[model samples]
Target: DANGTTWIYKPREKTAVMSRIPLLPYPMILLEKYERDAELRATGKLLPVPSNQKMNAYLKEIADICNIPKNLTTHVARHTFACLAVEYGMPIDVLAKILGHSNTNMTRHYTKFSEQLIGREMRKMNEQMFSDDVFLLNQ
Candidate 1:
């Protein structure tokens, strides 16, 4: 049963404890629905949280339903969150906070910038450096 509030799980080894992650509106709504379902099941009923294996199986089913070709796992969701945040220009420190990493280095493992993105940034920099006005100014 959810404590009706979100809690962060922090590892003792790390100073960074998991802090309350504010869910987006849709997810918050979904959480409310799940909580209500859990409440209903508590009434003379037993509905336990699924095991990791069961949860992964369900996640794979969801990916299949969505026609996603890649394998779906819990870790993939975390990685995706980090990668997307990086792509969207979120600072590494902020990403670390979201991922509950005590050190920024730990968060780096989750961030993977595509080669195409790197190339794009390089091209932008090159274009700015080699612009006609800049080149003329150098002469």
Candidate 2:
């Protein structure tokens, strides 16, 4: 559905919001197989993959098994991606584009301000403000 060439969804409703995401090299092989299977299935016009409920259930089960204290929802991955991108110093506007958000403000709502990010920003500001004074020795 991306530019009407790269098929975004594979018989599933999961929206491939990001068009230019670079997939891992090995998964390209698997993707080829999936495309072939999809072609054959489409000849008969059968439904594509089943609903996402089962996959989400599996994720929850895995989280429970692993004793993860937090609630394990499918959206957690998206949230984590946003947070990590911000932590790495990607600008809010760029992060918004990568996340397919309509505006930078929307991305801000999703990003959790971590201590590390706050500290890093504060350090940069301090260095810029005090660089000459800190380096100069006062007698």
Candidate 3:
């Protein structure tokens, strides 16, 4: 958090949500992930929890290594996630809740209305409105 906001994980307001992406769960894949997590994870946690300054420093180092011009921060990551979520058709109300926003308007502020999203939604609407079965005739 670049805004100096600190978070405490409460039972009701869970800080983390664990999910499994739909992929082939091969033993080799699982083993590799476990080994990588063991090397990278902080003690008693799934990932290293560094301070804001340290995290930003790490991001800066990574960006430098990757030759990225933009300064990457946690806010940047959150914004990117918001944009992708909207693009993927996650409801604004749902995304707002996940983003800890009080309203959908705030969520809208986080996402860009890209042409690709518009085109995809329009195509989906067309499919729902008129499909091959909708135009069938019995002779």
Candidate 4:
């Protein structure tokens, strides 16, 4: 029997590792409801895990509904996750581990930073190192 947490193992990596992902309270409750309605066991794997082809087809439909211009695929979702995580201030090392990347260099390839994000980070650095006193004093 397992608890509310699960580990995702990447055996194909050069160095195999497991990532612990917790099921937050709201999702846990929904999962419990699904289990009860589906008559699933604690040990049973979740059902209706769609195949890659089917998942890609569904993603295409979703992209259309969202008015996205690019092709959507599983790899695209991975890149999206990487981009969002970095854009939202997740550390590169932590993102690397979450992405099952063996090195930060590999993880860097997956993340694309926007010019605005770069400028924002630079501005934050400047604010931290300098103060308004450097600008002007009370007249």
Q: Which candidate leads the pack in lDDT?
A: 4
Better of 1 and 3 by lDDT: 1
Provide the RMSD of all predictions against the true structure, rounded to 1 decimal.
Answer: 6.5, 6.0, 9.3, 4.6
Structure candidate 1, residue pairs in collision:
none
Give the per-residue lDDT of model 2 (tens digit) for 1-139: 4543433333223454544544555656666666657665677532344456866787788889999877776678778889998999989988886677667988998899899999999999889868857656575
What lDDT score belongs to each candidate, Candidate 1 first? 0.75, 0.72, 0.73, 0.79
Top-TM-score candidate index: 4
Off-target runs (Cα >4 Å) in candidate 3 are 1-46, 132-139
| Model 4 segments more than 4 A misplaced | 1-16, 24-26, 37-43, 132-139
lDDT digits (tens) for residues 3-53 of candidate 4: 646443335444556654455577566665676544355546543457889
Instruction: State the displacement of the C-alpha of residue 16, model 3, in Å, after optimal TM-score superposition.
Output: 14
What does the lDDT read for residue 11 in candidate 1?
50
lDDT of 3 by residue, 1-139 (tens): 3654333343323444432222234643654565558655546553456987888899999999999999999788889989998988889888887777767898989999799999999998878766755645573
Candidate 1 global CA lDDT score: 0.75
Residue 20's C-alpha lDDT in candidate 4? 46
TM-scores of all predicted structures: 0.61, 0.62, 0.63, 0.74
In model 2, pairs of residues that clash are none
